[model samples]
Target: MSIEIKMPALSPTMEEGTLAKWLVKEGDTVKAGDLMAEIETDKATMEFEAVDEGVIAKIVVAEGTDGVKVGTVIAVLAGEGEDAGSVSAPKAESPKAEAPKAEAAPAPVAAPAPAPAAAPKADGDRIKASPLARRIAAEKGVDLSGVRGSGPNGRIVKADVADAKPGAAPAPKAAEAPAATAASAPAAAPALVWYDESIPHEVEKLSNIRKTIARRLTEAKQTIPHIYLTVDIQLDALLKLRGQLNKSLEARGVKLSVNDMLIKALAVALTQVPKCNVTFAGDQLVKYSRADISVAVSTPTGLITPIIRDAANIGLASISTQMKALADRAKEGKLQPHEYQGGTASISNMGMFGIKQFDAVINPPQAMILAVGAGEKRPYIVDDALGVATVMSATGSFDHRAVDGADGAELMKVFKALVESPMGLLA
Candidate 1:
């Protein structure tokens, strides 16, 4: 028997990926855990590993193929004692392929038999459900028994569990009938408007990463109610501290950037104002116990946020080292899913680019993002007298649904105090 090797889902949100490269070719012997291919997901390019030892019988999908869906067979492996040459690759059917004539009705008879074979088990055994479906049911407190299976062989799937109501009686078959009919009905296609080719322009296809970024940012702006709060903080104290820290750390080969200090300041502020470190769950507010800040990095493909896990607990030297590495890998598209996934809040600094002040879109599941601008000399009122001060404008974009205006203001106050004091971040 031959084992089919399918494209693996590298991230939870990954539905399709580019088959970037293949490390193994047909007739190549591979052991379990061996690297077989490089798959480029929306966030990063990850190495795919083999699970079973076998000889590569055939490569069904070639490298550089884009939009290869998850769970699609990419290759076939011949098991031990099986001849690699004898193993046949599955044929990829196209709409242009010739279809079977009416005389081939006998072939359809066997297909109907498999459908019945997948029917619900007898003897009142446990329901047949996908792992994802079971996990969703457990999380949603939905009873599996009450949920109807719409998958092949009457198996419960993720969609079925998602639509199932917890504690409520299963929908009557008559009620489900209309839904099934609606689902089966073909949706009308919208009219297509062709672009004018006479105009001089370039048509560049969007990469998977770019497309994902566009969709996610669009959703964030549309769904998350944004509340923007801006504060002007004196950066002289932070600058002096950074200079001294960098001098002392230079012996250790660690140079701290101003952004590193901002990261620490944001983390400390989150701890001081814990209420601001929260996310909006449908019916509940999820408050994080620790401050993990995602720092935005720009790559050739698009923007990515790589997290600094427990930024508050880590020292300035450690933050500098880790952030440098994370940013480097993020730009190279080598970051793992975990490195760029979850965070209590985020920091997107455009200070380096001389952006004075700008509001950033809130990354979903994260309630807030701090946008940092460049520090420049400005007239300040000190002791009721006008004076010069190096100040920077910091804007906090909070999800109005999760954080109150007072809490957001308090978070900003704490952040400004930490930066102005310059010693609390070290403490």
Candidate 2:
């Protein structure tokens, strides 16, 4: 017997990916948990592991193949006692076979649909669901035990889990609606335009990372209602405190950046104003108990946010040390999916680039993101008199649907206070 190995979904949102490289050849023998290939998803390149021990029989999809759909057969493996050389590759349907049918029947025949309410048991013990469905269920806190399957062999699919209501009765199989048909009318195509080729230029294709970024940011702007709030805070105190702390901690090899202190401040602010530390689900609001701050780091590929778990609880030195290591790894594209996946809120600092005051887009699921700008010398009022101070602008972008304006303002106030006071973050 031979086993067909299909392309695996590396992330929840991944529909297709590039098969970057294959580590094993046709004659190579592999054991369970052996590295087989490198798959490049929209976010990062990850290694794929073998789940069953066998000898590689054939490679259906070659390396460097882009946009290979998930669950498509990528390779074949010969089972125990099976001859690898004798295993035949799966045959693809030929267009000639369908030509006769097209002439006989003008209308095309639709493929047979799977049952709408088949509850396939996995290994005759556990419920079987797609990886995406499982992830969605976990995030939405929906009890999969109570959900019915509507996929082939009673396997649960994404649509089944998405339509499952949390804490509600399982929808009756008879009540399941038929899948909607495609529109009879075709969408109008946009006008084609071309640039003059006489002007010397080169065209570069968009990378997977760039494409994903464009799609996500466009969706974020169009779907998520954004509310921007800005506040100016005196950074003289924070700068002074950072200098003192760095001098004192020099022997310990821990030097903190202003961003490190800002991370702590934002985390503490979230705890103070807990309303801002939440995610907006379709029908539910998920409030987190701890502040896991996702700090945006720019790499050659694009921008990635690596999270610092329990930022409010960690010391400044630890935050600095951990952030440095995470940023380094992120630049090299070595971060694991879990490291950049989830956070209660996010922070994006552009102060290093001397960006004075700019708004940032809110990362979806998170209720808010704080954008930190450069600290510059400016005239300020001290005790109702004229004074020169180092000031910076901090802008907070909130999801209007999840966080109220007042709550967002309160969180910003607390953040500004902590940054100005400086001792609260250390304590």
Candidate 3:
């Protein structure tokens, strides 16, 4: 019997996907759990695996096809010596939560251009151009044998085209110029010259993930009035504590990062300022009993925030392990929907990237997000005496509808104390 293979729903929010590429070909044998196709969602490109072993029969959907609704049949799988006419599946309906299904068989592509025959020697026979240059000359309709090379032994380079006599049909006007003195540099970053008329561009339809992100962020910004609060934490103690912890944990092959400590501190501090932990729920406040913190990670396709559930209950050691796992999965685009969605709060740390300070957009349903910056040694007043201390700046973006100025400040107070003291996180 033949089996119809449809596009799998990689995430809860995925409604449609672009067929990026197919991995298998028609008439090829496939095994269960074999990689078949790569689908490009709004956020990432994920691989689809075959569920049933069979011989490839047909491919209905071609690659580069967009707006392909989920459950759309892209291919068919059949057993050896079996006719494929009996297979039937609802292609219009949503995909079932079945085991992995479908793999893309590699399809045929356009043939490559043939290599050019070798030109007679140019050493004394006048400079002969390469096949690529000859092809380019043909495309641009330029005579190659007539051009002389400025290169060693008279080998023609693109520069020879520009150096051609100006009156000679405008020597490759489209050719780019080589670098010159700094003064001749094209305005560092070139400034756009204004046009008298505007040119129209084709608009692309938004993908499912992009549409969801836009709608959620727009709603959060419009419905939820945001309040910003900034604070600087003296991290001398925190730095010392992290160094000590790393020394002890180094033997165990576990390394703790400063962000891990902050995650733990934020989780513990959320309990002290419960208001910040609550989400806006219609007319009432929906408070979470445990702190589920989402850490923002940048991926090739888009940004993905993976959650560390009940972070407050976990120690720094556990948080480090979970973060590494989450980062690896995120890069591979293999994370499940639940692994990234539904967090009460989020933390975005650009400290590693040397970002001094920046504000973050609050992810909806979550009332607040904390942006952390790099720690730097700076002059500070310590007990009425001027001293240099390592300090890092952080800013909290809170939903004004759920948290007020005083509430936001109080929440920062807890964050400041926890981060500055550092050792209190263990307590």
- Give the Cα lDDT of each candidate: 0.82, 0.81, 0.73
Give Cα distance to truth, residue 81, candidate 1, Å.
6.3
> What is every candidate's alpha-carbon RMSD to the true fold?
12.9, 13.7, 15.9
Q: lDDT by residue for model 2 over 253-315, one digit each (tens)?
A: 999999999999999999999999999898999999999999999988889899999999999
For model 1, the stretches where C-alpha displacement exceeds 4 angstroms are 27-34, 51-55, 79-83, 91-196, 382-384
Residue 343 accuracy (lDDT) in model 2: 93
Ranking by lDDT: 1, 2, 3
In model 3, the runs with Cα more than 4 Å from the true position are 83-215
Q: Compared with the true structure, what per-residue lDDT tens digits does model 3 show for residues 1-427?
A: 6788888888787888877778987777899989999897766677889999887777766565555679878888986568655544234233222211211111111212210111121111323343334433443445556787553234454545533443222222222111111212222222243443257654243444566668778888888888889999999999899999999999888899999999888888888898899898779999889999999888755578989999988889999999989988998888876788788899999998989888888998899999999998889988899999988999999988888889889989999999988878887
lDDT of 3: 0.73
Error of 1 at 256 (Å): 0.6
The model with the greater TM-score, 1 or 3, is: 1
Candidate scoring better on lDDT of 2 and 3:
2
My TM-score estimates for the predictions, one after another, are 0.74, 0.72, 0.70
> In terms of lDDT, which candidate is stronger, 1 or 3?
1
* Candidate 3 residue pairs that clash: 23-104, 23-106, 24-104, 24-105, 24-106, 25-105, 36-103, 36-104, 37-104
